[model samples]
Target: MAVVSVQQVSKIYGHRLSLVNALNNISFEIKSGEFVGIMGPSGAGKTTLLNMIATIDQPTHGRVLIKNQVVSRMREARLANFRRHELGFIFQDFNLLDSLTVRENILLPLALDKFSVAMIEQRLAQVSRVLGIGNLLARYPDEISIGQRQRVACGRAMITKPTLLLADEPTGSLDSKSATELLQYLTVINRQEKATILLVTHDAFTASYCRRILFIRDGQLFSEIIRNGNRQQFFNQIIDMQATIGGGGRYNAITPGH
Candidate 1:
């Protein structure tokens, strides 16, 4: 089943003389357990499209449906609840609260819903073990390395077991090694936990981790490439497509799984 259905969606800004169609009738569906990526040059509407799916932004035309519910039409209060409970997010900046310890940050979602104490602890252990942050639970975010911080961000996002995970440049702030490790962790989360992920990144190496990719250019769906072989081959394909479309993607010297 399709976990996300973006049907004939479009977003416009300003009006008349200054009208900007940030997204133009974009359409796609991400099925359950699929790992997908969106790649494009700056202002190619990658972030705009992601915002629509994330429910942080609305489409000026058409509708976005997640799990068969019309998100664009949802009332404010219901939308807030749905976004909190149904969506998981990992941003470029680790959005953890400094006052909260790693454990508190990871448990915030379940804690808000008033989950039983036993269940919350069970989820915390499971997520921390999977992300290899079992030892960092008591430590504050300030004490951890940048990589560990990102991992904690991952844990907090996964703690909810959200139906769909939206990641925007999650590895953008990390060094090469840390970026790779986080991607590996995301791969494990995608496979082991059967989580549906939609990642947005211009880096071909990062895009290669996805099973399929949607390349955007000039605020539209320029083209797409699916992984038919290994990560290296997919990386090459992403690079070639980016070149053809004049996408300004960096991290060129790096190779995936090398």
Candidate 2:
């Protein structure tokens, strides 16, 4: 089943005098339990497309459907409620509250929804275990390593059991080791928990973790590649595609095992 459907979506900025089309009639579907990646050059509208699907921005033309419900036309009031319940986000920077402990940070979403204390604790335990951060629950964000902090962020995003998890440049700041670890954790979540994820990154190494990738350029999807064999092969394929599409000018170099 298709969990997300973006149909003929176009996003335009400004008016007639100085108009910009950030996205141009892009259409795609992400099936349930699929791990997908969106990649492109610096000005290829990757973030703009992500924002539209995240419901943070509206499309100038066409509709976005999450589980068959039209989101582009939703009212602001209802949209807030829908976003809170159905979508989860992981940012490049760990967005955990400084004053809150790891446990409290992971439980924030459920707490906002007025979930009982018992229920919140139960959900927190499960997510913390899954992300291998059970030991860091009592520590402050500053007390943990960068990798652990990102795991906490992932735990928080998954506690709500959102229909879709949207990650934007999630590994952009981490070192190679930490980035690989986080990607492994995401793979485990996708396989074991059946969480549908859509990640946006310019790095081919990061995109290699996804089962499928969509490459965009100049406000349109230029091409796509699926992982047919080992991850190293997939990574090479992504590099080649990026070269063919004239991307990856600013992307970091990556090795086979790194």
Candidate 3:
């Protein structure tokens, strides 16, 4: 079954004379348990498309559906509740509260939703074990390495067992080794927990981690590459597509204008 569906969606900015189409009639489906990547050059509307799916922005035309429901049309209160429970997000920044212990931060969502103490502990244990942050739980955010903090962020996102995971430049802040470590953890999360992930990245190496990739250019679906063999071969394919689509160079996290 499809876990996410984007049907003929478009995002327009500005008035009639100055109108800009950030996305143009894009359509795709991400199947259940799929690890999908969205890649494009800057200003290609990658994040804009993701924001619509994140329920952070509405599409100017068309709609977004998750798990067969029209999320774009949901009422505010219900949408808020749904978003809190069903959608998980990971960004380049750790976004952890400085004052809270790693354990506290990971459990914040369940606490807010009033999950029973036993259940919260259960979820936390499972997530931390997978992410390998269990050893760092009692420490504050500042006490861990950048990689460890990112792992904690992953734990927090997975603790909810969200229907879909959205990630934007999640490895932007990490060094080569750190990036590889986090990616390994993510792959483990996807296979072991069957979490559906949609990640936006400009780096071919980062895109290579996905099972299938959707490439865009100038706000449209330009091409796609599915990993057919080993990771090395998949990495080469992603790099080739990046070159073909005029995308290469170092990049950081998504911005407001992206």
Candidate 4:
């Protein structure tokens, strides 16, 4: 079954006098256990689309369904509950609390839901082992390396075993080595845990990690490329596509405003 379904969704901003269509009739479905990427040039509405899927923003038209539940029309209270129970988010900056230990951070979501202490501990162990952060659970966020911190963040996101994981530029702040490490961890989790992920990134290197990529242009679905064999070939194809779409260059070249 599809874990996420976005149908004919559009997001508009500004008044009638100065209206902007950040997203224009976007539609897509991500099935279970699929790792997908949304790629685009700056101002192409990649993040806008991601926000709508995350339920952080609502579309001006059409519907967004997660597990067949129409989230676009959900009340605020129900939406908050749905977000807590069904969704996981990984941000580019590791949004960890300095005051909390790695273990505590990973258990925060369960605590909010009032899960039993024993249940939280079991999930903590499982997710930490999956992300290879089992050894760092006792450490504070400031004490761990950037790569380990990202792993801790991943652990927290997976502790809930969420239906869909939404990642926004998850590797944007890391060095090349650290970024590669985190991507490998993400791949492991996707394959082993059967987690469905939809990642938003402008970098070809990042998009290459996905099984399939959707390129957005001018707030519309432009094209899609699926990985057939090796990742190196997929990375090369992404680079070529970026070049064709005027999104080529170093990572800095494709910043928010380019």
| TM-score for each model | 0.97, 0.97, 0.95, 0.95
lDDT (C-alpha, whole model) for all candidates: 0.91, 0.92, 0.89, 0.90
Q: What is the C-alpha RMSD of each candidate to the true structure, in Å?
A: 1.4, 1.5, 4.4, 3.4
Better of 2 and 4 by lDDT: 2
2 versus 3: better TM-score goes to: 2
Q: Write the per-residue lDDT of candidate 4 for residues 1-258, one digit (tens) a residue.
A: 998999999999999999999999999999999999999889999999999999999999989999999998999999999999899999889899999999899888887687787888888888988888888988999999998998888888898999998899999999888888899999999999999999999887778889999999989999999999888778878887887787885443323222
Q: Which window of 10 residues has the lowest lDDT sum in candidate 1?
A: 248-257
Residue pairs in candidate 4 whose N, alpha carbon or C atoms collide under 3 angstroms: none
lDDT of 1 by residue, 135-170 (tens): 999999999999999999999999989999899999
Kindly list the per-residue Cα lDDT of model 3 for residues 1-258, writing each as its tens digit: 998999999999999899999999999999999999999988999999999999998998998999899998898898999899999999799899999999999987787786787888899889988888888989999999999989898888888999999999999999878888998999999999999999999887778789999998999999998989987778777777777788863242221122
Better of 2 and 4 by TM-score: 2
Off by over 4 Å in 3: 249-258
In model 3, residue pairs whose N, Cα or C atoms come closer than 3 Å (at least 3 residues apart or on different chains), thus clashing, are none
Off by over 4 Å in 4: 249-258
Error of 1 at 54 (Å): 0.2
